[model samples]
Target chain A: MIKNPFLRTFSLGVKSLLLHKLRSGLTTLGMLFGVASVVAMLAIGEGASKEAQDQIKQLGSNNIILRSVKPLEESNSNQSTRVSVYGLTDGDFARIVDTYPWAEDVVPVRILQQEVRFGERSLNPRVLATTAKYQSVTGRPMLEGRFLTESDEETVSNVCVLDYEIARYLFPFRSPINERIKIGADYFLVVGVMLPRVPIGEANQAAPGEEVTGEVILPASTGRKWFGDMQVKIRAGSRDMEQVDLHEIIVGVDSSENVPAAAAAAREMLDRTHRERDYEIVVPLELLLREQATKRIFKIVLASIAGISLLVGGIGIMNVMLATVTERTREIGVRRALGAKKRHIVMQFLVETIVLSVGGGVLGIALGLTIPEVVAAYTDMQPVVTPAAPILAFAISVGTGLLFGMYPAWRAANMDPVEALRHE
Target chain B: MAEEKSKAMNVSLEATAKAAADTRAVAEFRNVSRIYRMGDNEVHALDDVSCRFNAGDYWAIMGSSGSGKSTMLNLLGCIDRPTNGEYYVSGTAVSTLNDDDLSELRGRHIGFIFQSFNLIPQLNVLENILVPRFYLEDPGIGLVERARDIAERVGLGSRTDHRPRELSGGQQQRVAIARALINDPSLLLADEATGNLDTQTTEEILELFDELHSDGMTILLVTHEEEVGKRAEQVMRLKDGAIESVAYNRPTIQR
Candidate 1:
């Protein structure tokens, strides 16, 4: 009877929703929670992934690390097998710096596990011997005293930097800076302490015969003079053991763009220099990329799981709407008898569903916004909330409502007036 | 009294005598038959029925439960179509009209009152009376004022705002009557308008129908009761979907 069919149908929809407030509310709850969970899960996953990526990126995406790998034959050989030798030396680092134009900075490291004693305080720790340039290359910041200087390396000074955890463990009562510590009868002064860094692999554990309590950093020149190609002893049996000479080196490139080329260049040079393949180059940047790819896939899977709930919510809406159609059969008959057209009936139901879904969507958005904060407070997992997430969630919810509402609305519109009137 | 009686007899004879007079017909049925098919069976609701009624006339169709009285009322109300043959209202062949045209014709020319006083339960008495006006193109009459006028004329002025559920059987039927007359249609079709009411309520409805006929409104009333049929100016009895008898009443002169 009315010319403005949209407005009329919309008003009728509002009235219908009002008629069954509880049913509408319950139906809306399903959609609300569905959308909220989808947004919240994605936000949390994104936050964790972003934090990891930032840490990796801070590790300098351009850096390439090379570590020694002892051959299986060397391990199985007799204890008297004259100290098996492997991995990069001063020659490999010199060659990469000289040959590759892309090589901007190079920092080589040698590691030794030794028992250090200061009075009754005796502890074994991972002692890294590296150049002063290592500090700038790895972006490692010093918390106290000073980092290794070029003068210290030149003079072969016995200056050392302690990891924060090691300093606290070694000198619990006093700051370890400027304190003298002994490493296998050699005295070294602790110059500075480094802040804590996230452990690379599994939770902090030591390699065999390696110390776990603290880390000791020293100049590479001083390390070469004292340890002089330190040997690692591996025992196969009670009496059968072998000593191996190997070194772990981390080479920093100019930028992330040059990392792949640097790695390739280093691999080519190493392949030619070593008669036997006894070295492995580990690229933390490549691992970081792989991890990022995995996280992206993880996010998609998490989002899909959350999307299932939204689908369920839509089905819930359809179910309730169908029930409503049956419940209001008499009302539809009355309206039809009063001159309402088929389209009017269809629009009335459609608008009712839209109102329910939109109301739920708005509430879901509010709920989704608080999810990050809620997760941070109640759980160890961090949640990241982005504007796009909630917006997409709302859109998805509304779309779901519209898609699911059609069948029931069509059923209502096509109802026979005579049969509907006689429906009990 | 004698003069009045003689004048009434003269008027009655003149009306019967002038049945074949050349006047424009308001409703006509020519060999109209209605057959209802139920599965493999067929039942003739109205068989080869032919009838005509002039403008400004009051007629009653009387019959038993299965006598097709209600079918005739439905046909006159345009709520149904004849199975075969032609039925005309206001000189328009109704059987040939499409659904839209039929509905328009019903809105403009025919109004109906049902046996059960079929008022929408949620609507007020006034709203019930204005239901037909919703279908009108212009509604010609101011809905509120017309509703109020009809309510008052039917002795329901005080109850215009009351819902159908709140009204008594006779009050509801009166509202239905008011609704049927709201459009000022050419023909008023009532199907047992007072069927659900008590004797007093039936008398009130019949008195209202009498007043409506006196006001020059043509009326077709379907009823099973002889008393109800006898009250109208003409009576046609239907039996087994065929006309059984026709009778004319004694009409009173205007003066």
Candidate 2:
């Protein structure tokens, strides 16, 4: 071909790469897979962590939780008959509110898993026994009618608010408000219908949320006065009595920024008050922050793995280029004799490596974009394909090409002209 | 004759000074020595040897293998540096020129023809001819036309599209000769230009060299054959890393 003399070296670079097609292709493939995996891994990890953060945020960033676990001394499943008393006491409740002034609307709740029946329809649901402030504090808007007022708390009234799911299930055809529902021997009037909420699965419950589920909400005083804490059950020729005074206390801080401090103060107070280590502190804000930190580390680990593969690809280019320098020793000598400078020799070799790596980088980006969508389509996982991923991968590939191409190019440029000319 | 030339070095230097005054010798070696080191031993390729090549002088350097003639050819070609001493090309000291300047000097002034017809196997004849001029920015509009003209002059005008392997030894040498002449260099350095050609083609190649020499081209021919040396106006013989003799082929009758 009548190649332009200025572009002759450039064409030579391309021709050389094409000459060793298999080796070039394998090296490009190494970078291609590396970049693809990097983009895909980043997208997946970001997507997973983003979803977790969203779930935690649903519980409110300012909320803290205190869960009452059964004390080891009082509770034993191996023993047939015993009376157990543990968890948040009335005195502990008064003390927490007194110490942490930033704590706003600290709602004490007693959750009872009980079966409720109307006439013939019966279903098992959670009984959330809380105060009148639980309505505005939990932030669940009433869908119809009205929520239980302070009058319900003072009189120990037999009044309740049904969750959306239970409201629909219990009264599918007609208005269920102002109607009576029976739980065991007692009857309660349904005053309000709350909006349906996303289910709090067990994993999500690790971070706290408002005390609302597929259940009934009534005054904690009324539930305590009527049912009492001693739950006596007779089954299989044995009697089991379990008593939990207060199941959980949802403490809301005045602001999200104060959550960590409030959580620390609550923990300190609980530790000093209760010697059993029975109370576990759950601050959704703090937990979310920790999760974010972990996710950052995860991203770096993933990127590093990808970087190593690109390094391997770079080494492959270096290996092939060194062989090329040896093979073209005489050619280099001829060029030097004919007026090619050292830089010309260096440029020629560098262009070849760049061609290989850039070609691989472009292909890798295409694969990266596709893999994530394919994964999300075929599996339960959703991979967030961020724009930065492909760009970052491509940049790394080019950088890798330059980094590894240096030694071989330098060697080629520095060859002794006389000895090289004599090389067969 | 050798001792006379060596003793009265001013005689030759004066002749070069009288010829052009400002532009003296095309090439000059001032006490040049090239030593090769292999482990603890050293090989003296050229030991304190000095020579001058005046403008338009066709000189053939004849020597056997290991006589350091190839080493001399490499240094003369500006592809190798002297281990000691200075070399000047057309009054410019080569030792003072950096690598880039040396390459520029080679591009502008020196052209080479090899016995092996070392045409880049991948490039066609036309492309190979343009190799020396590649480094120039805008080698001007008539390069292709100039290349075409040179190709025709070398009798390879019809074979511009053919690769080196496709051509016979004679044709390949013509291409190398065409490449050598394309730069219109101050010196044409040929390493056994007709070594691989048949006798008939060798005579034909020598006739071309004669035509080029009479046209006022300065030529440096490094060869082994006595016949090749006989064709030149002057011959410098080397033996054991030193110059054995420098002699004129015949009395000069033409200007």
Candidate 3:
């Protein structure tokens, strides 16, 4: 078939639109926001999920988390005043090292809530007694100085890494590096300050709670010397002594596939060592799987909301086109008298609507792309622009035009030529 | 080969043509009847009206209100159909043609001129003349030059680019005439071509029509004015949807 005179028709469509610029522009605005919202919302969803994935990925797939739980065996003996301590012991730790040859690093941590003092400022913060491997495992970036090394642990150096919040409070006017904070009797040198983690998921979306925010880091050797693990006192109304060897343990295996086996093996070893249930194991990889499944639903809901706006935009196009058809009845009559067929009439109107929708789509893509950068700069949220988003939005806008333009074009095409000529 | 076949066909049609042997009518109506319904009342717009328009003949239809002259003009233009009876244009039965075929017939063979000089306000004079030809596939060779020639022929030589709103009443009518003649149609139907014009402008328009008629163009005009009727070689008067008389004026002006 001969190619229809599309360029001529298109130019004519442009001419007609130029005749009523204000009306056409107002109609275009509806489609613009519709497409823009689609792109922007999708980008935000992608960015949020990307951050969540990155946070989950930081905890290596092969890594296992085991936390200490005080057993209830001695809880009723002293009720409010008596201290009870039952958790991961040295025997369990030793047995795990002997059993799992594939387990590379067995990081031990002993945590105690203590008041840290610096000159005029004193704040209660959790003091974490852990190895330098904590930075490698958690993937938290340092803001100043350096983290504890093997040498620091071997020499039992009294150096600590201060979380940025505590550092800011303790040394308001100066860098916390090389500054000493007095914990109990000894003053420990601050080696580094950690950049705050961009806490992912529920933590960021929740209400205020007494969740752990700021903490001081110490080499395991220094913690053992300063804060003894075997001896601890609880002061409620009367003082009582409790014996706790370790608070938590992080075990890393060679590969993700070996995690289950290593975790089960470690569990067996811990079971033989402890007569009471005093430890819980968590797999970051398994938690990541569950989070991924939930995020799919979140993405769909966001996309649907944006899609609804686009649908509304299409309706706006239909409204404008119907008015235009009514206004151009005389023109249609003239065209028919000049030998235009119904197909020709349909093509003419389709060209006009396609021009409107496609114009709006291009504008919307530009707006959508810019919004992400604007949001990222002005707010804490990051938006990711995927390649498919703009293309998909553009396609939908054109489709919307074709879909909505059908009725108006049909109405124009079917009008009686004589009656149309008689129209004012 | 196709042209030879069509030429032979035309000769045979001329011999068997429904009108008189000597005068070959370009458009012929055979007992045509057109009735309109006005709320259960059947109004006979054209009650069994019969007419023939020969090639190269100039004629005028004169009628008063409710005389069915408008319906006759519409039938000539091929924009409307007769409810009953046969109408032929260029040897083809118009009643048998579909909407698209009718449009093509009008575009290729017939030209219509409205009283109001309904030139689209947006298009300039040259573009207005080109509107009819835009419907044709090839629009023939020298399309632009032909349009220019028609514009110049109608005394719109230098103002081809001027829009309808900018032109005077006479000038706009000239543009409409140029548009009607751009297709070089065989039959021209002018309905009150000089209705909205001054006496002087009407005379000028009538002279132009006379000039076209002398150039072998078949012209049919619908009007109520005796002056317009006098300009034609034949005049058909209609009263109440039927022909009253066919009068031939004495010696139509040579100019």
Chain B TM-score of candidate number 3:
0.90
* lDDT of candidate 3 over B24-77, digit per residue (tens): 768888678878889999899998888888888899999998999988887777
DockQ of every candidate structure: 0.10, 0.41, 0.30
List iRMS for all predictions: 4.6, 2.1, 3.6
Q: Summarize candidate 1's per-residue lDDT along B169-252 as a digit string, tens digits.
A: 998888888887887888888878777888898999999988988888888988888888888999999999999998888683
lDDT score, residue B55, model 3?
88
Residue pairs in collision within model 3: none
Give a tens-digit lDDT track for model 3, residues A178-265.
Answer: 8888987888999999965454344344243434357899998998898886545557676565667778888878778888788787
lDDT of 1: 0.77
| Residue A72 lDDT, candidate 2, scale 0-100 | 67
| Winning candidate number (TM-score) | 2
lDDT over C-alpha atoms for residue B185 of model 1? 87
The weakest ten consecutive residues by lDDT in model 3 chain B span B1-10
Each model's number of backbone clashes?
Answer: 2, 0, 0
Output the TM-score of candidate 2.
0.77
Ranking by DockQ: 2, 3, 1
Model 1's chain A TM-score stands at 0.79
Cα lDDT, model 1, residue B105? 80
Worst 10 residues of 2 chain A by lDDT: A203-212
